[model samples]
Target: MTIPTPPPGPEPLRETIARHGLDARKALGQHFLLDPGITARIAGLAGDLAGQNVVEVGPGPGGLTRALLDSEAGRVVAVEVDTRAVAIITELASRAGGRLEVIEADAMRLDLTTLCPAPRQVIANLPYNVGTPLLVGWLRQAAAWTRLTLMFQQEVAERICAAPGSAHYGRLGVLAQWTCRCGVLMHIPPGAFSPPPKVHSAVVGLIPHAHQPDAALFRAMEQVTAAAFGQRRKMLRGALKPLGGESLLAEAGIDGSRRAETLDIAEFDRLARLHMRRAAA
Candidate 1:
């Protein structure tokens, strides 16, 4: 089959989708982004892609795929689980003049660090079903990348970039902010995709932290946040009953009477540090 060349004009996106008869698959949580302008905007947020490796997930109809290749990126490795989409991506990859590599596999099951080389960046309009887990996985293995620019439902984006004590703040916010510098670069309305998703979306960028103040303290930080936010409405003492409860707070210099949602990220880190010290001794 002759692979169609990358769209040469502004309307290439819609034309490609129509020509290919590519329909978004609900089973894959697929939402085809058909706006070249939006794709360009997203790629711009990724900063300098020159000679850098980028991994894209769920490249439905290759909207963002074209943009990444158009950028100066050395290579773009697109991972798509859907068999049909994978076939379509194969065509897109061929037309990309060897800059795009389409992988047919489940992104969650893959170890990205091993898949792509150094100077890596992840830029994707992630599938809604798997977006959070993917973000958490990448954030946990943060040493693998220099930066990540991804799209998610607006609510999830807010949670990822939310400040301490904000209503959107929770385990995701704490973990993401602790390991990386996160910011929301753009807000995408529901209408941006071919089949508009019910919720609005946003692009977020995360630059991983190189020097962690308390690297060993993350275990306790995870335990503390899980307990605290697990019962956010309760007083810290009551909510954290499993992990030394009030005693843990007293030792960490945090007030036991405060609710979990009210505590900031600094306080969480302090508690983690205290827990680490106790464990060591």
Candidate 2:
């Protein structure tokens, strides 16, 4: 569990990428964050990693992976879907003095609960294409991880932290905010990446609430959000027609004339609770 001083990898990240022939693959939504200082800052956003097992997704060239190791985390488990990136990080694991483990698999398919023991936090510059889905999946089981410090495309990050009535607010904001205390930690310009992405990116930190929604309630919330925001332009009475419509709104004590975006998280939670109750009956 001892991390070597000066960080591992004999060569610089750019050189390592060159030596390994690891070009940023657009198909995998890869945008490599090779700057150690930036990566270190990202790791720092996770806060007090000591004795915490940290899980990293898409550890391209292991820049952030190295930072996590240096953070003195109890253990760092990196999951990479790209074989090329996996190979790169596998080499990093070798220098980590048994403190790092690399898993070559699609993070979407893996059960995160089984990745490691308790006191876990997920810190990563997530692959853009799969980032939202990954966050949604993790949000469903929000209580499992201690905190999730992740990077996402700027707009997506806005959506996650967006408030009701804001243009960016929607289902993502509802689900994430409902279960966790979320905020934007930092913003990164496109130039920070190996091959800069077209859009700016932002890092978001989410600490799950002590009282998370139960399975049924969560499902109800999902259903409610999908129905409400699916046709966001429509009033609740119309948008929610498929899910008991006006009657559901009436039961939940919500105004049927309201548009989806106007409803706050508590309103949504109430709708979800009523939706669940009706479905059960």
TM-score of candidate 1 to 2 decimals: 0.91
Task: Tell how far residue 30 is off in model 2, in angstroms.
Answer: 0.3
Question: lDDT of each prediction vs. the true structure?
Answer: 0.85, 0.92
The local distance difference test score of model 1 is 0.85
> What lDDT tens digits, residue by residue, belong to model 1 across residues 24-111?
8777778888888999889999999998999999897788988898899999999988776776678777667788888888999998
Cα misplacement distance, residue 155 of candidate 1 (Å):
0.7
lDDT of 2 at 274: 92
Instruction: For candidate 2, write residues 21-137 as lDDT tens digits.
Output: 889989899999988999999999999998999999999999999889889799999999888778778888888789999998999999877989989999999999999999999
Q: How much is 276 displaced in model 1, in angstroms?
A: 4.3
Q: After superposition, how far is residue 189 of candidate 1 from its true place, in Å?
A: 0.9
